[model samples]
Target: MTDTPGVSDPVAGKTTGASSAGVQSSGRTAARGMAWTALSLVVSKLLSFGSQVALGYLLAVDTYAIFALLTTAMIFVNGFQNPGVSKMLIQQHDRLDEILPDYSAFALWLGSIGLVLFLVVGIGFEMTYDVRPLFWVIALAGLSIPLKAATTVYMAVMSVNYDFRAISMAEMKRSLFYYVVLVGAAALGAAGYTMALALAAATLFHVALLKRATPGLRLSWKLTPRRFWQMTVEMRWVLLSSFLFALGMNGDYLLLGEMLSAEELGYYFFGFTLVANLTVMISMGINQALLPLFSKLKHDLAQLRRQYLRISGAVTLMISILCIGLVGIGPMLVHLVWGGKWDPAIVVVVSIAAVLPVRLTANLAGVVFESQGAWGWRLMTLIWDAGFILICAFVGATLDGFNGATIAVALQRLVSGLLTFPLAANMIGIAPRRTVGFFARCFTVYGAVVVAMLLADPWRGVSVHDSTLILRPMLETAAALAVFLAYNLAFNRELMVAMLGILRRKKTP
Candidate 1:
C-alpha cells in the first residue's frame, strides 16, 4: 500500500496525504520511464556488441586500433566541453519552456568553444606525432560536439518530462545508424574520414529525429547575462567531475597500455570490457529514471529518504548476488568455451567483480547529489575516487603488474563507495549509520549465502574439458541467488514488491 520504497517504517506516519499523492504519481511515472529505458538498453547493448563484432571481423586488428584511438580522443573532446552541464536542465525548478531558449543558447556557445578547443589539442597531437589521417579524424569527429550541443537542451527537456520512450527509441535508432555506417565503412576499408563522417551523421540524424519527437521545441538565439552566469555556476563543478569521470573510466586503458605489453593489456581490456558492459546493462539501465524521479521529490525530504533507501537497498541486493554469480560461473564458462584463451584474465575479472556490491551501491548516491543540485558534492566524490583510482593503478602496477593494478581499481571503488555513503546521507538528511547498515546487511545476507555455496562447491573436481564442468557452478549460483531473493522476500518484501510493482505492466484505461 506504500508508494515509496519503504524499508522498516520510512518516516513512519510522518508523510501527509498530499505528499503521498506525489509519491504515487512519481511511482507510476518512474515505472513507465524504466520500462522504455530497459527496452532501449537491451537493444542498444545488443547493437553495440554486434557492431564491435562486425567491425572486428571486417577490419584488421591494427586498422581497427586507429578507429578505437579516435573514439577515445572524441570522448575526451566531449568531456572537455563540460557536456554534463546540459543535464542541469533536468534539475531546474523553473519552468522548462521559459528557460529552454536561454539554455539552448548556452549550449551553442559551449559547444562551439568546445569544438575549437578539441581542434587545438587534437591538431597538436597529430602534428607533434606526425600521425597521418589523425588530423582529419580529429576535425571531422569533433563536429558532433557542436551538433550534439545544439540538441542537448531538447534531450534534457525530454528527460525531465520522463518521456523516455522518445529518448530510448532515439538512442537505439541512433546507435543502429552509427554502427551501420561504421561497419559499412570498415567493409570498404577502414579510414579515419569514414569514422568521423559516421559519427557526425549519427548526431545530425538523432537531432533531426528528436526535433520531431518534440515538435513544439526549437532552438532559439536568446540569452541573458544573468542566466548565462547562473548556468555556468551550476555546471562548474560537474564539468570538472565529467572530465575526471572520463579519466577514471579510461585511466585503466591509458595507464595499463603504457605499463604493460600489448598482449597483457589486451587481456586486461578483455576482463574490463566484460565487467563494464555488464555493469552498464544492469545498473545504469535500472537507475536511468532516478534523476528525473529524484528531481521531482527534491522538495519532499521524507519521500526522498524513503525512495533512496528503497532503490539503493534493492540495487545492493541485486549486485551482491550478481557479483558472486559472475565469479562462480565465469571461470568454468571461460575455460570450457574459449578453451582457456582468457584464463590469464580470470583473476583480473574476478577481482573487479568482487567489489560490485559497493561500486554499484555508490552510483545510486549520485542521483541524490544531482537532484539536490549538490554539484560540488558530486564533484568531490569524483575527485577523490577518480584520483585515487589512477594513483592506485600506478602503485598497483609497480607492485604486482596487471593483477595488482586491477585489484587496486577495485579498492579505489570501495573507498569511494564508503565516501559516497556519508555525502548522500548528509545531503538527504538521512542517518548515515542507517543507510550504511542497510547496505551492509544486504551484502552480508547474500555474501554469506554465496560464500557458503562456494565452500560447498561439490563439482570442484570436474575437468574443464568436460561439458559437465558448468553444471555444479550453475546450480550453486542459482542456489545463492535464490537465497538472496528469498531473503529479500522474507525480510525486505515490501521494498522488493514495490520495485516490482513499479516495473510491472499496469493496465491502461
Candidate 2:
C-alpha cells in the first residue's frame, strides 16, 4: 500500500535525492534490457522470416491458410492462460520468491484448463467445418500450453531480476529450434502440420532452457487458495484487459477466415504477418523492457510521464520510418521475395502500413496504463478497440471483401489511437493538448514523407507491364529516403541530435 523505498508518491509532487537516484538507476537497467531484447528480436525475426518464406514457397495458399487459422486459435487460447499473473509478479518488488510457488501452481492449473479447452474447441471446429487436419494441428499445438505457461513463470522471474539477457538467450534458442523443425518438417512435405509440430517442440525446449536458466526455481503443484484468490482479485481486470487486447488484435484473423475464402484469408494472413512482425519488433522489443522500469517509477508520476514521452517519441520515429519504407517498397519486396503470386497481398500490406504509427503509439499507451495500475482504463480502451475493429471489419468484409476489411481495420486503429491517447495522457497528469501536439508533430513528419514518396514515384509514367520491377522500387526508395533525411535535418535536427547524443553516451559508458 505504501510507496516502495526510494519511490516518491506522484500526488506529493516531490521527491528526495534518493528517489531521483533510484529513477536514474532504473532507467539504465531498462535501457540495457531493451538492448538485449532488440538483439533477440532481430535474430529471431530473421529466422522466422526465413521459415515463413520457405513455407510460403513450399505449401499451397489454402494449406498455409489452414495453418494460419489453427495458429491463431492456439495463440488466442494461450492468451487466457493466467493472463495477468506474470504481470502481477513483475509488479511486485518484494516477496517474489515467496510467491513463486503459488504463482507456478496457478499457471499450471490455468494451462491445463487451457489445453483441455483448446482440444474441445478444436474438435468442435473440426465437426462444424469438417476440416480434419485443423483438429489434428490444434490438438498437437495444444500440448505446448502447459510448457509455455511454465516458461512464462520463469521469464517473469528473470524479468523481475532484470536478467533479460537470459530471457533473450532462451528466445534465441526457441527460434533456432523452431526454424530447424519447421524447415525439416516442410521439406518432408508435412504441410500445415509442420507449423503445429514445430511450435509444440520449440515451446517444450524453451521451457526446459528457461527452467535451467532460472536458478533455484522448480515447478510446484501446491496452491495456496488464499494467496491465489488475492492475486486473482488483484488481477481480474488485468486478465480481462489481456483477453480484450488479444481479441482486438487477433479477432480479425478469425473474422477473415469465417467471412472470406481460403485464398483471400491467406493473402490477408501474409500481409498481417508482415505488419505484425514489425509491430513485435517495436512493441515487445521496447515496451516489455519498459514494464519493470515503469513499475519502479509508477509512484513517481513525473518520472514515469517524462520516460513515457521520450520513449514513445523514439518508438514513433522508428515505427514511422519502417511504415514509410513499407509503403514505398513493400509491394516490390513482396514480388521479389515471394514472387508475383502474392501480388494480391500488396494492397493489404499497404493498407495496414497506413496505421502502424498510430497502432504502435496506442500499444505504448497500454503499457503505460498497465504499469500505473490502471487496468480498468486499459480494459475499457481494449473493449472499445475490439468493438470498433470487429464491427468495421465485418461490415467491410460484407461490402467489398478482403481489401475493404483491411482498410476498415486500419481506420479502426486510427480511431482507437485518437480516443486512447488523450485518456492515457490524462491518467499520467499530462495535458491532453500536449499529447495531441506530440502526435501532430510526429505525424507531420510522416505526412511529409508520404507526400515526398508520392512525388518520387518512379513508376508514374512507366507502364507496369514494361517497367523494371526491382529498379523502380529501388529508385523510389532512395528518393524517399533522401527526402525524409532532408526534412528531418531541416525541421527535426534538435531531436536527431539529442538521439545521437544519447546513443553516444550509451556507447561511451
Candidate 3:
C-alpha cells in the first residue's frame, strides 16, 4: 500500500530498507493523504458555506453577530485548552501507546481548567463589557469539553498513523451533520440557530461512527497522573507557543469588538473567520501528513530541506492564487453568497486575502517547528505573536476604526511570514541565506503578478450595487492568474514543475 499509488501492500512504496519498508513509503502516502484531505475539506467547506449563506438569508445581522462572538470566545478558550499537545505527541512519535493514557488525562484536565477559566472570563467579560443577554448563550457552549478532548485524541491518533482516509471521511461527515443541524435550526429562526451552533458538536458524535468503521482503536477513560505531569511539562513550551500564535491570530477580533460597534466588528469578523478557516483547512490537509513525514525525515537534512521548499512553494502558489481571485471578485461573492447586506465585509475579505500568502508561509514554519521537536525554537514566534497583538491594539485604537484594524492584521501577517524563514531554517538545520533566497524568488514572482494586476486596471471598481457584475472580476482574476502562472513557468521553473507534477499525479491516480 505504501510502495506505490493505490497499492494493496501496506509497505509497497518503501525507499528505505525492506524491514523498515513502511517508514520509507511516505511519498505515495502523502499524495493519497493530501488528495483525500483536500476532497474532504473542499466538500466540508462548501457545505458550511452553504449553511452560512442560508443563515445570512434567514437571520438578522444582530443574531449573526451574537453567534460570531460565541465562536470567537470559544476560539479564545480553546487556546487555554492547548490542543497543540496532540500535534506534539504525533510529532514526537515515541512511546505513544504508553504515553497516550497520560496525555489523555492531561487533555481532560486542561479541558476542565479551560472550562472554569472561560466561565470566569465570560462572566467578567459580560460585566465589564456590558454585553448582551445572549452572551450567556455563548458561554453555555463550553459543555462540549469532553467531546473536544476526545476529538483531540482521535485526530492526533489518526494523524500520527497517516490514516488520512479516515480523517477525511470523519471530517466530511462532521461537516454535513453540522450543516444539517444549522439549516434545520435556522428554519426555526434566531434562537434555534444559536442553539444549533452552540451545540454543533455533531462532528464529535460522528467520531463514534468513525470508530465503528475503524475498530482497533479504543477509547480509554483511565487517568494516568504521572504520565500526565510528564506530558504537561514537555508541552508547556508548546502551550505557550500555541497561545501566542492564537493571540496573534485572533487579537484583531478581540480589539475590534472592544473598539468598534458589534455591527462593524461583525463584518470584519466574518471576513476574518472565512479567511482563517480556509487557510486552516488548507493547512490541515497538508499538515495532517506533513508532520509525520517531516518527523521521519528530520535527520535527513537534505531531504528535509527539499521537502520544505516544495511544500512552502506549493502552499504559496495556492494561497497567492486564491488571494488574487478573491480580491478581484470579492465584492460580487459577498453580494451573491451573503446578499447585499454584507457588502461592507468585501473589502475586509479582499484585504485579508491579500496578506494570506504570508500566513500560509507561517504554517510551513509551524511544520518545521513541529518536526524539530525543540520547544525553544518556537520562543521567537511567541515574541512575534505578542508584538503583533500590541501592534494591532495600538494601531486599531489610533487609526480609522475597523478597516484600520484589518489593515494592521494584514501587515502583521506579512511580518509573520517573513519572520518564518529564519525560524524554520534554525530548526531544520538549513542555511538561513538559502531559505531567504527561496522566499525572495517567491516574493519577486508575487510582486510581478501584483504589478500586472495594477497595470491592467489601476483603479478596478470594487464597489457593488443592484447588478451582479461578475464579469469584471472574472476578467481581472483571469488576467492576474495568467501573468502569475506564466511568470512562474518562465522564471520559477522548479516551483512550477513541482506543482504541475503534484496535480498530474493526483489526476492520474
lDDT string, candidate 2, 1-509, tens digits: 34444444333345567666666665567557766776787788789878878877887777757765785575456455646667778787577878778878888877887899899878876775533488888988889888888877887888888887898898888889989999999899988798888989998999889888976988798877786677667667876776777778777776777888888888888777777767766666565577878887787676677667666665566567777878787777777677666777777777778678877788888878878888779888988888887898899999999878988887887787777877887888777667777777677767777656656653232225445665776677777767766776787664454344333323211
RMSD over all Cα atoms, model 1: 4.5
Q: Which ranges of candidate 3 are over 4 A from the true structure?
A: 1-24, 79-82, 191-199, 224-227, 451-470, 500-509
Give per-residue CA lDDT, model 3, range 293-364, as digits (tens).
888777655556656776577657766777787666666677766647877777577767777886678777
Clash total of candidate 3: 5
Candidate numbers, best TM-score first, in rank order? 2, 3, 1
Clashes of 1: 0
Clashes of 2: 0
Q: Score residue 176 of candidate 2 by CA lDDT.
A: 95
TM-score per candidate: 0.84, 0.90, 0.87
Give the best candidate by lDDT. 2
lDDT of candidates 1 onward, in order? 0.68, 0.74, 0.67
lDDT of 2 at 36: 78
For candidate 1, lDDT tens digit of each residue in 1-509? Answer: 22344322264535455455656666667667766765776687677667655653454333433443454465465554446644577777367767777778888777887899878867765755323576778788888887788766766777777777788788789879987987787777755466787888999999888888999888876777787778778676766776777665556555555566545665666566556666655544454577878887787777777777766665565467667777778667555545556566666666677677777766778778878888778788877776787798899999999788878887887677777866887677776667666766666686577557557653252344555665778877787778778878888875576556544633111
Whole-model lDDT, candidate 1?
A: 0.68
Query: Model 2, residue 142: what's the lDDT?
Result: 89
Off by over 4 Å in 2: 1-23, 130-132, 224-234, 451-469, 489-509
